[model samples]
Target: MVRTIRHRTMTTNSSKTPSSHATRQQNSNKLSRTKKACFGLMTTVLGLVAIELTLALLGVGRSNADGDPMMGFSKQVPLLERYVDEDGKAWMRTAENKLVWFNDQRFPLTKPANTQRIFCLGGSTTFGRPYDDNTSFAGWLREWLPHVDASSRYEVFNAGGVSYASYRVAAVMEELANHEPDLFIVYTGQNEFLERRTYADFFEQTKAQLWLTGLVSQTRTYAAIDSILRKNAPQESDADSIVLAAEVDERLNHTVGPSDYVRDDEWSDKVREHFKFNIRRMIHIARSANAKILFVVPASNEKDCSPFKPDSEDGSFETGQRSFDAGDFASARAAFQLAIDRDICPLRAPSNFAQFIRDLPESDDVRVLDFESELRNVCIDEHGHDILGEEYFLDHVHPTIDAHRQLSRWLISEMREAGWMAADSIALNELSAETVEGVDQSILGRIDRTAQGIAMRNLAKVMHWAGRFEVAAPRARDAIELLDGDAESQFILADCLRWTGQIDEAVVEFEKGVSAYPTYFRGVQRYGLLLLELGDNDAAREMFSIATLGWPETDPRHWAARFQLSIAHLGACDFESAHRELQECREHTPGDMDVVFAIAEASVGIGEPEKAIELYEQVLDEFPNDVDTHLNLAHTLLSTKQTDRAAGHFATALSLAPDNERAQAGMMVIDQLKQSAE
Candidate 1:
């Protein structure tokens, strides 16, 4: 149906074309306006979308704000709390929740006022694990300094952490400065270049990559993309983690091939620079806090250093290389080679590093403790290997508690020489007792020394053990005067006074003992026990609490103090407090029969027969031979109206220990009660 579309073609003449151009211009203006409007609308829509997406990605939306996704993820990861081991010792965890310091207290951050506080900063070596806290170098220093100067009242605080590098140590120093410490002692360097990648590397690998990307993402789509990528990325299997760790250890040991650039002079220079930088930062922080600083180049076993072969013409590198052949020679060789290349030769490196450190301007105020020299002399054998037979070290690097004691003695000597301590203090004399004991008695006897104090103190100890208070008192007093206010001497003196009806004087002496060395919990606990004996239950409980809280949780004395506090609570008729103390004591020493019995007694006092019965059963099952347990169980059963059971337990107790007065009394009562019932 082609109705032929007739098209009218307009032909413009040259004069008429101008008028046609004007009409076309109007149409073009209209098109331009429409395009501008479209562009404006698109730009506005995109801007709003961007704002919304940014809010979403940042988790700023109301729904996301209400629900913490990051917190949820964190919850899925286990949080490691401080835990006590089977041996009633505590283990420390890192900020990352990784187990670090085993069977030791986490380093404290605070220092007391008006006291000269020395903060020992280092790795596990300084932390002094597998040793009693009192035997740690810090503890040793505290114990020995008094020998150098009996009146020296310096408080040494060990702030060491496991796997801590120099940078971490510096951070710890900064954190600790808030506690107003007077001196900062640094014992680090081995871990500086030995631990897998430095803090700088960790920051680069994690913060720069994941943290920055997370910060910059705008849209949920981009955020999801990043998350998915992170999730899908290959997870490190346990075996892989272990292998990687081994590889890291190899790298730290300097096992890299010569072809690798790590062994170059530049690498050494960089390591030196890293150490210097950290040291400088540490100095700055200490200076800012008006604290004195000392740098200790860590000492290592002879095996840690290149073997000292006088005749074997071996370069340091060659000597290290030889160590590689001792074990799986290939692995050992790799380890030795890497160690040399990285300057990880523990013995040699400390000396070299010390020299470098000494040259620094900051070192003007910083004393070098010469730990390397001391350790080398003590730990090295004739064959240029570590003497592991002594049990003074746990491994090639870490010192045992006994070793820490030795180091502490050396440190005290150095400190005395440096004029950091007093010369005439009682502590110095007491600490020197051991050294003097090693001295020839003939040489000591040549001096016109009065034997009054020494003889009296010894006699008092013997008499006290024999329960002869009348004889011990005068001797203890003379000894206290001779010992010149030594805490142990004062404690003995107080015990004597307490036994001789001089209660007021005894309390004063006990207080003096505690005042002399607040860190000495034995004295404090004794004072508390004395208070309990004096019928000051409230005061005794307070003292016991203070003593227990003063030391680390793993300290045996800390548990003992808690047990004492429970006894105080019992004396004061505070059953709830007694129960709480018993619970804490039980937690620390689960197998302790005394603690179990105490808990049962506390439960009975609190009218919890069921709990008491359970605790009694536990004591009987585990400590069937314990007379006290049997006696307590009898009383608990009698209270619960189980007379027959009480009588049977009493009979067993009599069989185990026939002279047990409490058990006999309990049996008599049970028999009488049963007779009355019959």
Candidate 2:
């Protein structure tokens, strides 16, 4: 019995050991599973928190899912259009499409029968802002000029539009060429420099933007990838837009690289060339369309108001300086000094710009009037703050109503000097009428007689210059009757007859004018130009030579005479003589593109394509955005068998000015060639 108990205890002990081992293994597995589950839950919760934090930091939650800002405000707004009233008969829209109407009836276009109609073309100042129509320069002109005769009346039409430059004014002239006005008055020059970019600069920027946009659009897939990367990236500061806008404005205004602050002489040359080219084109169009063109140089704010002076030692004129320098005599003197330093003297600068215009042989027909000195004198007050005073300007730039009035008065004086006035019969009737019954008749009669002669002579001269042969002839005859054998009148009569297909009669009048005023280059030059047109080459050349000898070297007519002589040589097929004349022109004026192009054409005629190519390249270098140059260069390249290079340039040219047919055709050929090569 004891042996059996021992055996049972041993068995029990063995069984308990196995069961403990199994229980220990089960507890170890359960602990491992619980640890893994806890770690996974913590990781998932942390990841969700991180995502929420990122969205909040990016401001993504405030924006729509598509990435637009939640607010409905747009960054850009459309530009407003502007318009204005023209005369009493019609309303005209401004370039920006704003509506304006004249408040006065005195400047009405509808006068009595046979009125001397004057149409004025210019920009905003000419439009007479802040002044009612009755108080405008047009109204003043109407009040000033009496009717010429019973058959004639006096009327002034203010056709000026706000912000219009010479180009737009030319367009208006073209539109009104058939109106049969006795005179077309043009007052401009200020807006030309400010309103539009030089043609070359405009085209260059246009091309660059187009090409860059095209390249960007072509790489849209890459852009999309970048957008995705940017979205996933960490958020940063948001001051980029303000900085970018400033950079853009600077680029647009300066047109030069930011690192460079010095004036770009190359760009200045391009600008000069551009203005010269466009002005020449304008003159040609005006002459061809029989419109008398007169240029008016406007006063500069700096010249009228600023008080800066250049340092004589360094030639540096600091801008934005409005304080007088020590020892300056007056504010006006200081302002004038500042203007001279900045090259803002309207008379001087416009004359310089006009000199460039006149340098072109094709621009001999246009006339330039210098009103700078007169306007300057008129603009200054006794206190030297300008006639309109400091408070009359919105800024340093634009003029107020009071300023406009001053401008008007100045313009009226110039017009009077130029001999623009009304008719005799209308003057007599107006003086005799109830409106002026109480006025002084003797003073009115004397004024009327003086005005009649001046008006008739001026009307005749304007018409003759404009190539209105039929209309001008009668006016000239009338002038000769009223002014009593005036030499200038005879010269104008001769020009009118000559242009109207009455050569012999014109020669007679020209001879009479020359006999009366032997030193008058005007008569001589007109005769010379007429002779040239009639193919009397030798006579034309002689007349031009004589005129040059009589006129001062600095005179515009002197250069004009030289140009005519050059044309005569060119017409005679004397390329050597022509070249000599052109060289003289270049010596007098460097970078004259018209002369340069003419020289290049002469070189081409002489079978010097290599020289032509060089000149053409020079032109392109100077005016890379000139469509004509690009076309010419493409032609030259094609002649030289540079097909691929020419194709690339043509493509670039077309990209800049999409309306270029030649470039488009060239591009098409290039595509075909490339495809065949592939």
Candidate 3:
């Protein structure tokens, strides 16, 4: 029995041996595959990293932009720059201070103990246009802070920039947070339309794509690859919709204000949305830095300031004017409000600004001051009319000196109410008119009649630019009464007359305004233009020469003056000088078709028929139906003995403008040339 049991045990052991060997072999194969997969992945990753590093080192994907990069902007921009001085101390200042955007400000690298650093932010109203910071609310706050608070040494920074929109203010606020700001007093709204940026396909991006893009954007490798692809791909060069210029390009200010703007309700709605975004962004930035934020509800001179750009038809603007004329103040007010609400170019703070401020969900760190209503109440008390104007405002939105004082006092009161300032000191509040009026307060001196006159003329010029000739004429007259010898008012009034078809009256005014400005002046420029129109080429040449001489090449006015001078040269048939001036202007504004056309005309006059023909071809390609271009090209071709080509252009010009005198002349010349050939 023991021998039989041993044989069975030996057979069972032999059967299990083969099964164990098969299982072991299977497990070994699985482990080997895993090792191979891991090795392949590691090699691929190494190769990718090597390629990425190589592209990054080549500097393939880099772009230079100015101002603060925000909200889907790929371009890198910085507002504030940190610089170390010779004394081994770091200071912070606005980059490119000479741009005249931001008021001059200096802050140390480190925040001081027992120091309350206040930053006042906003648009041109905050920057104090027609005057400067001293007369602005920011300036008043700096001076008045000492009376209101004593515990902390107050350092009020005028962070207000000229033509700065709410977006720019928010961008600046972001930078101020890094400087250890105790408080940020934001006073924006008037300049929302001054600068704009469109985020190309920002909202259209899928969440996954956004996430992936955000991740890759952080890497130099991705930027390089994107740059390379963009360079290689056939695409529109200026297709991207981001506004990258460091300074605000106020559209109305740059272009013929009347021609550039039209009622685009969609764009207006977008602007309102952006205004809200900027306010929320500022709040977020303040909270992130643990800084206190206060928003000032901005006011507008609705009842006083006329609609800058009125509709062509007699519409709400006319109704408002009639209402005001009829002494129906209530109806006038309503109509005026409607006009501003429907305004195509809203340089003044829109009604939505006040609503936006009041709508912000107030938190412990956030504060809102309804200064708009406060200003109106003050207007009611002082002027017996609730409508604010020259009584408390310099222009549409810029507050007068006394209004700035009122703003400062109100801000102090708000500070005390918010418990930001410990004491409600009566010292600043009790300031009698004698103390302020008696002393020469700011560097520019107390708001004198000269300053007021300058501001008035400025207002008139803006009105004139906007094609509001009727209102601008009266304002210019008022400015002249105050300024006496001021040429700006004179020229603006002259322009009003000229535009109104009173040629003789305009000529008289233009003559009076000539040679008024010592340096560059709008009046002098306008006078030169009038001279050009009147065929006084020598006088026009002299006027433009003076205008361009003083300003640096960096100033747009310098190039503009040069352009005018070139036209003046053309008027005198001085082809060489005209060509030189146009060439210089071309250097400034390369794509200006007006300059190109003028250059072509000058080339023709200078006996370069072939060059003129080439330039005319370029212009005709872009503006095929342009009668002037066709006629000019025809004339140029005729000079080059290209009768067939000349006849073709002349025929086209006649078709486009049958009554065009120059086109008629060109056609007659072409017919004569063909007949001579026959």
Q: Best by TM-score, which number?
A: 3
Candidate 3 lDDT, tens digit per residue, 1-678?
887898888788877765677889988999999999999999988887887778667755423121223343333356567888899999876677533677666677787888888889988777777577777888888767665566668888888888888877787777678789889998988888765566555555676875675555656666666678868976443566464465676676568674577777766776777687678878877877888999999987776666777655536756877887787767877787777777777777777777889778876788888887898788778766565665676567777777777888788888877778766444554766764543326523656778778877887887777776765776798789988866678888988999878889988887777645445366678778878988999999988998887578998888888999999999999999999989888888888888989999999889898888888888877878888888888877877778888889889988988888888888787677668878
TM-score winner between 1 and 2, please give it.
1
Q: State candidate 3's TM-score.
A: 0.61
- Count of steric clashes across candidates, in order: 16, 23, 0
Q: Which pairs of residues have clashing backbones in candidate 3?
A: none
Off by over 4 Å in 1: 1-99, 102-114, 129-134, 146-152, 195-268, 304-351, 358-365, 375-394, 400-402, 423-678
- The Cα error of candidate 1 at residue 613, in Å, is 75
Residue 547, model 3, lDDT: 82
Please report, as a residue range, the 10-residue window in candidate 2 with the lowest summed lDDT: 64-73
> lDDT for every model?
0.61, 0.54, 0.76
State the local distance difference test value for candidate 1. Answer: 0.61
Structural similarity to truth (TM-score) of each candidate? 0.36, 0.33, 0.61
lDDT for position 70 in model 2:
10
Give candidate 3's error at residue 662 in angstroms: 21
Give the true-structure RMSD of model 2: 28.4
* Model 1 lDDT tens row, 1-678: 233322222333444554667879988899999999999999987986786678677775322111111111212222123555677766432335333442233422333344577788877677664333444577667655544554435666666765566655665576667566678888777665454332233223444674454344534555556567868977644332212131113232353221122224544555566676678777777777887787776655333333211222335435444553453344543444344334422222434566666465544455666665566555445334332222444433566555676676666665555555554543344544556554324223433224435645665665555454554565567667765645556787787688768899889888887777776667678889889988999999878977887778877777888899999999999999999888877887788978888888888888998888898888778867877777777778888888889898899899998888987888789778878888
